[model samples]
Target: MAQQALPVRTARLGRALGPEPTSVSGVVLLLPGGEESSVRRPSPMMATASVRALGRRLARTGRADGLVAHVVHYRYRGWNGGEAHLAQDASWAADEAVRRYGDVTVCLLGYDMGARAALRSAGHEAVNSVVALAPWLPEQDVATPAEPVRQLAGRRVLIVHGTNDERNDPELSFRLAARAKKANRDVCRFEVHSDGHALYQHRHEVHALTEDFVLGALCGRGFSRPVEDALQAPPPLGLRMPLATGFGRSLRR
Candidate 1:
């Protein structure tokens, strides 16, 4: 007789960073980057500080509108190939948000490998939008399948990439964004000039853009001119718009 397969168990390891679930109208799930392949359980430190900071900023910006943020802690410290363990964790987080909030909208915000996971999991019923920062898109080859965009049909999508990133290829992300935009006109891509994988040079602008997109998608807030133009513009233009400096400061004015 064949041996029985044991069921895999995953832990729920994340905390809400704003209004209580019952009181919130929307959720932003933050996913941090990881390695290409590893099954080791993720440590607390594995949650990138950049992702945490962005989550806090988003929570503060959307506080009045009842938008809470949750940083999703992946079960593993890597993408784990075809298994897509990180994406599975993100999807579970989205489902958990719906279960806790009872019909509230969800936005997935992720960086690097986490961005890949966010894009992969945006098909979740609770997800209304996705923000991918320096996403790690797989190289198009016979051995690897292209990431699917059909799941993004009705959701808003934003891809922010650093031109100087040495890790993930910005061109790959641009290609994916173009494909997604073809299917869903709401998709847009922003290029952060002279920045690296961490996007530290334009961190504030990136965060601001994310806040604007997430708020607009979940709270009915209006988008800034550049964002609006990008969304409304035709291919190549919308897919290659630049992220201007002082975006966060300008928003305050």
Candidate 2:
């Protein structure tokens, strides 16, 4: 099998329709926003870029050792990161990833509007898990970047956003948190302090913390010893959910 040049994953608009299954314990595809990082990088960047970096890093880290990770790059539009655009990207990635990776527990990861798009894709593929960091879901009539927060019922969703983020306030994240809880989905939220819109802005502790969450969530239930230890003994477990939840600030999950 020829090695993939970049973190490329299977994708098609809306639904998937290809095959040549590769087996694994789980599969994750990272989707970055339609920014210059995506257009310029032989690979993508920004929130989407960060996820791609995380995907590649995780793959190199213990997370990818026993799992499958691919970074899906889609041409979503607008600064806000709306539904129509995200949905198209998610569908394409989900279909393609599922086709190639088979039914191994699947997860679509993203951040900000990219997170919104991942949820939309999850709804379509009935994806097992969704890791939406700094997901932006505003109230109705607010003309949110994404049109209705994609229903996350029966899905495992992890929502993370920064407390002092200027673009999307804590209120917006709260609105999303409440909706996820109401849906009775296996969902959790984490807030990062001293963090802004960019994940890179966060400290190494934040990255390590986030990597733990991403690994745990994607690793599925039956985790190995090193994976479990790495996940718990880090910034994620150390973070206080209440404080971050109160203001939408800590990165604990």
Q: Rate the local accuracy (lDDT) of all candidates.
A: 0.87, 0.55
Where is model 1 poorest over a 10-residue stretch in terms of lDDT? 4-13
- Return the top candidate by TM-score: 1
Clashes of 1: 0
> Model 1 reaches what TM-score against the true structure?
0.94
Residue by residue across 1-253, what tens digits does model 2's lDDT show? 9864443333332211122123366666676654312322223334344665566555655443356677665653433233255557677776766676566566777777677678766775537777777665555665534334455766666666677778766567656656555544356665676677764455454455445655666664343333334323333331224212122133343
Per-residue C-alpha lDDT of model 1 across residues 1-253, encoded as one tens digit per residue: 9986424558473677755534789999999998899877777764657598888888888888889998888878888888898999999999898888788999999999999999999999889999999999999899988889999889999999999999999999988988888889999999999999999998888988998899898888888888889999998999899999888676741
TM-score of each: 0.94, 0.67
Tell me how candidate 2 scores on lDDT: 0.55
Best by lDDT: 1
